[model samples]
Target: MTNITLQYLTQEQVDQFYRDGYLRLPHFLSPDETEALLTRARQLLSDFSVEDHPLTKFTTGDDNHVGDDYFLTSGDKIRYFLEEEAIDKDGKLTRPKEKAVNKIGHGLHELDPAYRKVTLENPAIKGVARDLRFHHDPVALQSMVICKQQHIGGEVPEHNDSTFLYTDPPSALGFWIPLEKCTAENGALSFLPGSHLTAPITKRFVRLPQGGTGFEELIPPGQAPAHPEGKYTLEACEPGDLVLIHGSVLHKSEKNRSPATRFAYTFHMIESAPHAVYDAKNWLQPTPALPFSRVLDDGPNASVHPAAGRV
Candidate 1:
């Protein structure tokens, strides 16, 4: 295994993160590494059989949230979700399977070699975690390759990562890497600057007692500060650029109406210290067979979990 020294963040950068709620680092991944992940994502999409799929469409809107058994149990398995606009009235895909799918998610960090390489084994990521003062071991989970397909991709509402992956102190941090150039036309992310410090997590996306999923209130609605529309700043990125998103930061992306597709790989990490409790009601959970991997537990190049046989 290769030995890697933890790279600490500069004081300026640290201050910026605390102030802005996000940091965009250019050229964080090599060209080869970026291409490898893109290729792997395409391969996964091609290999997935749409014939037997449950046609679960991923939605973050208040009315049609996905909470089926396939989606709930997908925390440990590789699963594909379709875009809401991709399915026709007759329950068939309007485009090819590759173009119709919205994302492949929730386990790539632990199951795929390509994803694991950039996630668990990446020295720079480990360094970032250390610099961020994650005193306890950070547990990485909810890996995903979001396919913002051309024309048919759906819009994502403004939300915080912690609302979905909640912990006691709200330590979820997102590492987002775009495989292709992201632009305003192709669904690049727009963030509400400094919202991490201002926006309190008042609701959580959780499994409902009746069996599906719903948002449970953490606090009364009127207490939290309102997120006004005009403050968002659009961030366009290229391949290899890394966007670090704070857990409480408010962010969202528009529909991909351009001719090009935007592919991005992302994963979240939460502190696993005894005090930072991971909520049991969170949609994504760890099982005995596929527990969340600690970021610093393995050596720089060591594999935290055996790669899945499929990829």
Candidate 2:
């Protein structure tokens, strides 16, 4: 008999996710919760100083190196990066702090109390992970608040999360939630349904031990696997909507041209199994390879596996 405790999503929802490679939950957060997040986001934006902020353009179009000191040192701390295009010829911010930032990230779930209370630390998250039936226990990997700045929000090219956080057999998933409304004008996500079924990871973003970063291709150049044509779908999201994206899905968002800002919080999870291996060169790993947050409690005799070293 199936255990009742493992049920978070209905069987239909689960089946739909596997079939389409994505799932949308409209009421993932309450209006009150959404408002709180929005307020917090605004405060963070307003308070963030631009005097020494690193201009980090948000890009996922092609495999690019991210070996700067700022990028390498930000995995465990709350830091802000500026929109690359928003800088003036003098290499300074062209707009105020409120409109110049690109993202605040890579650690909100573990460092921010507000985020942790509603996400990683929430029981529902673990329950959902259990229901997903991951190959091994799932652990929260990377967390960030995507600040889709008005008029300067950059485009995010189609790519899979596994390309950046790959496991030996490829196990990764995303949890994205908007704190404000997201629309086509403000760069909402557009996905190719069932893309995960056909699309294979093309390359990986890796970093050298000494310094620098680059792509490690898995397939021949220009011959990467692709999904079927004319299957594109765009989502118009409300403040509380949640999106679950599969690791192999092909998805992207356009540049925000609207005057409104589209802010969202997102994070990814991966399996921590003895057989799973994380490449030592991945760009976003914690420097010391700390144990990631576990989705399931370690029962009696539950021991940490070797794969836990990379998470």
Candidate 3:
């Protein structure tokens, strides 16, 4: 929930973006900015702890919150994750504490400087880190993903950000930021070259049929795929470097057999617009299978919750 205005863009940067559809913005957030976001995220988790966290209904963890099977499939889990559970409304998690909030969930993204909205990833969510499954931001066409890997096998899958999500043409930007040092051993991202500039790629995705792994690959293979020049490997990055990507790009994460958790954060960006949630004009929306991030409209002086201005 950082309060940031889009003012740092330069002519050269814009040109690069036009050429590649994405550009890396290193050290965009100062240390203070990043820390402030971490604080806010921790605060939210603390509050969820105090209150009877109601979002537990949508989770079914097999290995603690590390690997959860949700009743809601296809859509992004955030929608169902945040929804008030009709059944287990009592926020008490049935799963062990190890699964409740994993250490990796601490990878917080430093959004606009104000640090207003922070994306929270529980162990259950990260445990499902099998594949991106090819989707995109709908209206805002922007999202941020952050994480820290404590296990040696935490990896991210690859796919076009908008392959099956939307077809309005690539106007979305994907930003990957690291909270901790990222190296090949720690699990960095690998991408395809000039793939983002090519026309939108669309094809029916048929899984292995027997459900090999939930979060394995973002793009489940269907028919033959165009051989987009797969010639890009993101350079290893330091603690504060960020990789900005185009929505049309094809990318995936590498192996992470390291002893410690690989900590990183990601954000999806779309041009500012109105009525963005469900409109087709935007192509980055999640596929028919994933849930969607609804359009949020808060009236004047609105606090995140209705409790604000209450007394």
Candidate 4:
């Protein structure tokens, strides 16, 4: 791979991230780059045949509804999930694969060349990881293409990324890129700005070693509800825009009711600390089951979890 230099974030941008718990890049990618990503997404979807495909539905809970081998093994492979509501009462698909697919997910960055080039090897991404001041290297752990399918796209409830990708001391960071125009009408993300600074992660969604999934809470849910006066703001974005989110930020997207699909690519990263033992129960383990890739090399005070409180 050729060496690539990324544009560094300005002091103002850095300040904004520290203050707001998130940062938005208006033009993170050029028009051609956006087109290339979209093309790659379409091609992947088209190339996947529906025949004998294990149809999984999008769910936010820890439990795997399908519990099938395909769904279980997809942690390191490209796979598809069908929109739950897209199935009829007769238990048959209501639409064809092109429209019925919920998303192509869970591992595109590690498995697909196009996605890998832009996400894992991209300079801008590496730069952001460094700017965040991680202690150890920044390791990219999970990747997915979220498809907010027209009309049937489901709502994702407010939750933090660390709840699913927990480490001994929380370290997850999210990189979300919209592949097309995202508007309120099409399920744009709404965030509770600055929530990360105050709200502590309460629970974790984990995959049990004995074979299923469950939640482990640091504190009960009652202690961590959004502030009574907290303001939730929606961010409408165009293709190529990137949304970098703190692991503990509270955010969600509403169900899509429009005719157009809202396609976006997303991934998560964590500080690769020798002292940080990733919870054995966390989902998305490394392939060969080794450690996650170190995308960015160094920084200061890397851990994201609180040291002495009821977080």
| Candidate that scores best on lDDT | 1
Kindly list the per-residue Cα lDDT of model 2 for residues 51-170, writing each as its tens digit.
666676555545454467787767787788777678888887787877877788887787788887778777666666666664456778788889889998988887888888888777
- lDDT (Cα) of model 3: 0.41
- TM-score of decoy 2: 0.89
TM-score of each: 0.92, 0.89, 0.53, 0.88
**How many backbone overlaps does candidate 2 show?**
0
- What's the residue-level lDDT of 6 in candidate 4? 29
Regions of model 2 farther than 4 Å from truth: 1-6, 61-65, 287-290, 298-311
Question: Global lDDT of each model?
Answer: 0.84, 0.76, 0.41, 0.76
Off by over 4 Å in 4: 1-7, 61-68, 221-228, 289-291, 297-311
**Model 1: ten consecutive residues of lowest lDDT:** 302-311
Better of 1 and 3 by lDDT: 1
Model 3 TM-score (2 dp): 0.53
Against the true structure, what is every candidate's RMSD? Answer: 6.7, 4.1, 13.0, 4.5
- Between prediction 1 and prediction 3, the one with superior TM-score is 1
lDDT of candidate 1 over 1-311, digit per residue (tens): 33334366675676677777888888999999999999999999999999899999998797678899999999898999999999999998999999998999889999999999999889888888766553357789789999999998789899998888888877788999999999999999999987776678888889998899999888787876676445899999999899988888899999999999999999998877574788689888899999998887643322211110000
Across residues 7-121, which tens digit of lDDT does each residue of candidate 4 receive?
5777577667666778898999888888898899888878888787856676664444344456667778889888888877876789877777777877888878988889878
Give the TM-score (vs. native) of candidate 4.
Answer: 0.88
lDDT of 1: 0.84
